[model samples]
Target: MRRLLALLVLLVLPLAGAHAQGDPPGVKGLFLLTDYPSQTVRAGEVTTIRVKVNNAGLVPEPLALSLQGVPAGWKADILGGGQPVAAVMAGVNQDVTVQIRVEVPKDAKPGSQNLVLNARGQIGQQASLPLTLTVGTETPAKLSLKSRLPSLRGTPRSAFEYTLTVGNDSGKDLTVALSAQGPANFQSTFTEGFGSNEISSIPIEAGQTKDIKLKVTPPRDVKAGDYPVLVKVAAEGATAEMRVTLQVSGQGKLALSTKDGRLSGEAEIGKASTYTLILNNDGTAPVEEVEMSGTVPANWKVEFNPKTIPSIAPNDKKEVQVAVTPADKAIAGDYVASFRANGRGEQASADFRITVTTSTLWGIVGVGVIAVALLVLLGAVARFGRR
Candidate 1:
């Protein structure tokens, strides 16, 4: 009877040990947090925290998850109702995704909000890795200014147009003010909503581009040269600027005229006759440093009224004189003289025709002898008739 009982006890002990191996008494698995991003989130943003309950035991068990330490405006949701998982098999892993939402007000100060997620199961209870929630005010929008028309090159009194490109690099919308500064004569105008010489607010969204036109007109009296103009763009907390060059040029008109097409006075050899040529500036611009030169007959001389005339303003005119003389031994039927005037990008010339006549002398002696002979003949005729 004793031998039979020992055999029965040994069999029962082996069976109990087999059941114990199937179901472990203490927690024998790792409940790890997975699927959750690096534990930090911005205010007003939502982040998902995931927990993976890994069971490395011989038996299955249930799992329960819960969240804690969330701020007032923040909230968290767990999968499986924070209840114990029905049965997590030994050496098997279970996954849980918890969503954390942060609702920070606009007035929320910049600081860190601490959050914790606790997952409990039959095997053990595991706390999730600490998550840091950063709350702060949104960043301001960024603004930039660009000029499409690089330079303006035109005569004074003429209007010039410039196009401007405005870019917004912020993550939000922005309204920018526009202005310009340069020479007093330089005038600028923008699109309808964007006025001239005032704060023009333009609404631009993040990563957006807009085009505007700026019409610049220099005063009529402005000199010919390069002038710099500044274009400014400003937003709530951002500002930008661009520079433009305004080039002014001179404007003028030139005309040429002659007193006579032909030169006709009869003169002896070695005598001279003069003719005139005129140049005028009809436009409202000055002509400076006049000069006259051209090929002409050797005996001809060309001269200007004022050898080096100063600047001739609008509606001003200047004259030049030319003189022609024949050589003493030359017989002159007709001669041509040509000349040209150069000043302020203008040129002109004239041709002159000269005639020379023979000198007077001898013939009076022959006429006196012929008259005496006629008188003698008449006297003889009268005497014969009386006899």
Candidate 2:
């Protein structure tokens, strides 16, 4: 019986420290620690702190977590795996890290502040950890450029807009000039958020930030590829740069259309009619060695003037005359014809309907027959009257 009592004492001794701290029985080795839980950041900046929980207990424990004593206008969250967590499951004798993201407001005062986090486990098991963060009035550098999105995609002639926040950490107001360098024929501009006013330079107050919009436009003739653009902002004593990537997609485009309003026109049998067709390059690259061809009905002929064009630049148009002829013995009806213009990597086609009609001589002969019949009737009436 004495030996049995001694075994019970050994078990109760391990939990004495836990009971003194008001933690649940048999719950020990729960610690909140981190290598970088405290840091100094600029005002209006966002910072993240890592808190590691080392659970040496044999059983898994779900610990409820929360942030306490957060400043006004500041946001704080306990995140696990990039998302907020209501509770963290601590494995036996293992370590897990949780992230705390702290967003400081722009109007926050510059000073040192302390934040506390409370974690509660099963059976009234609780732990409170304190973290320190220092806010500096001045940023690390005199000029800082921040962009939410640095890469964008578009087709040739597509417009790309990016919003960037420029911070002036200097103690005085600064006049900042903005510029960008990109491929030839590309256009870019800077503008303020309000009034859409185009601005080459802007003034930022001391320790303040301003938002700028960068609008980039690739030329219609630009090739399909990745183009890197560097945006630079410079002041009297500071400079900042940001690199933007523009992805241009799709091959060149070609279009074929008739100059006249009618895709269908009237023509006489056994004769040829002329129509004008235009080939347009609406894509990025120049089309070279463009060959023209057509599909027509049996025994019909189609011809194109100039045979083929040497080259057509982007956004430019070239005119070609097409002469279509029908067979002499062919009947008057409607016929469909398709024409094509092809280049190295692009092609365009257009369909047309040709309506055939008889010659005017047939109409004139019918009119003569009617007139002769009227004369004959008049003669018969005169002879009958005399009798």
Candidate 3:
């Protein structure tokens, strides 16, 4: 009977020790905040605040947290803990997120406002996690236009290229429209987003930059001068403008000089003789308003199609055709003629040599006549001898 009683006392002693070590009365979990940005808020903007609560006691505990000291027009939301954060184990932490929205008036003064967030539970309470909110007006955006190559100067018919740099110095993204104006004959081709007369939109991110290529081609007839071109850039909130100058110059060109200035064709003295003269513009600029003049022998007549050409660019060549006809009374021989083309800078000339020969049909007729004469003479001699 004594052995049984001693065993009962051993078991009872262990149960009492376990009951004392389980959990203290009214002990709760520790509430910790995580995943929250620094304690600052933008006036009239919505911000999210997040935190985690941990049960640091030996047993599971339920937690309830509340927010305090928010602005009049602001509201706070407890997204994670509507049902009272329940069953958190000892030494383990639970996560909670709180979203706070602050609405500042349009005419709100520019200054700093104070705010506080509180966390509470059945056994413990933590108050006033300090946060600061600022209220101010935002500044407008500013945009600017700059050019990589500001001036274009070249000879007529030469290609002029430029690169423009568009910058957005504002705190927000901006869309800029671009346009350019220049002379009528001066052709300009901009990149896809740019246009000659129409404004095209180009999106530039905040504090970003972009490059646009502009190409210009002057007309061959454009004279040397300082022509002003306007480039305009406009945005929804801002506008910018720039100017470009185009200078044209005349350059002495190399030309082809014709040495052989004559042409010949076999004709029955009245047939036509065709002559070709080549005019080359070797100058750096194009040549326009070309006038051609040619002189032929008195016995021959001259006719040319398109006696004058409108224009010819540099390093370009044009041919002028001249038709000459000899008079019926003229003899078959060589003929000489000269031609000149008057252009913008200088004159080009060609000398032509022409040879006139008898027709093949006339030669055949002469041979036939000689053969008939020989036959006739032979026949007369034979008849005389026989007589």
Candidate 4:
């Protein structure tokens, strides 16, 4: 009886060690096992591995799953039943499919990565699934096109400049054709350097970058807003493109002048003189809220008929009546007055020389005095001749 009991205990020890917690429900003999396919992936790519869990138990079994030894910047997800799950159920004597989704980072290096898939049951049944991932060193078709200044601001009918770079990683020399697509009437040109001659294409060596300048000119009548320009660089069969934004600034030009284009005018002391001032908008946009102001000499008053102009259309002109009055005691001489018209951050100014003459009353008094002296002199001459 002692020999038989010792042999029985020895047989039970092996069974207990095989399952520390015990076997799962309805699983009398077999332990948890996991099987999956291996993978070979490239950096900046994603691939999925299929894993099948086999359960030979008499009833369904839930197994906890986990992954280990995943590299930095790499992602792994275990999914069951078409959804991401940490645990899966396997029917009796059936295989449950689990998906292992992996994503390799763009900067990942080429190497062999070891991954372990661990599955644990509540009854202490556990299995580790080993997976090997081979990362390829082959560089993908590479071409990067970017701009130093992707967006710019300028007025219509002006030129905007941008510096662009093209990178080649094709392990050979690449001749890239350059082109730009923009709105109607928008002109674009590519140059090897700033202010250099234009070119239609450029070449870059392996692992090298080339810099080029792009000059974009909008139409003369483009509205004040944003526009898009697409720049493309193409090699043998590869293409790279970038979109550059051009912010159009509004133009408000207030050109001030007189109808006769003369900056000088005549005036009389203690009297008013009127002149027609012309305001022209030479820009592609309208000028608004235009106000006229003048710098006058002492005791002189300058006034505008409208005081403030409502608006001036592009390439259009408006007239304002300017009235100048000298002080009551102003002397008769030449004086200068500076006038400026301002509109929405735009201004134009001109200086005028105002020649002031004496009042009409003074002129009439001098003429009467001259006439009296002449008459008296004439009568004196007649009397002397008679004598």
Which residue pairs clash in candidate 4? none
Candidate 4 per-residue lDDT over residues 218-327, each given as its tens digit: 98667788999999999888889999999998787777898889889899887889999898998868888899999898888999887898889988999888899999
Task: Output the better candidate (2/4) by TM-score.
Answer: 4
Q: Report lDDT per candidate.
A: 0.62, 0.83, 0.65, 0.83
lDDT of each residue in 104-163, candidate 2, tens digit only:
888888888889988788866677788888887763338888899988988775799989
Candidate 1 vs candidate 4: which has greater TM-score?
4
Give a tens-digit lDDT track for model 1, residues 217-254.
Answer: 88766767898888888887788888888787776655
Candidate 4 ranges with C-alpha deviation above 4 Å: 1-144, 147-154, 157-159, 174-203, 219-221, 234-243, 257-266, 276-289, 297-299, 305-321, 327-336, 351-358, 383-387
**Model 2 lDDT, residue 241, Cα:** 94
Q: Pick the candidate with the highest TM-score.
A: 4
Error of 1 at 221 (Å): 2.2
Query: CA shift at 13, candidate 2, in angstroms?
Result: 24
The digit string of per-residue lDDT tens for model 3 on 268-322 reads 4778866566677766667778887777778778777668888887678877777
Listed in order, each prediction's TM-score against the native is: 0.38, 0.44, 0.43, 0.48
The ten-residue window of minimal lDDT in model 2 covers 16-25
Error of 3 at 375 (Å): 7.7
Q: What is the TM-score of candidate 2?
A: 0.44
Off by over 4 Å in 1: 1-104, 108-136, 192-199, 253-316, 319-387
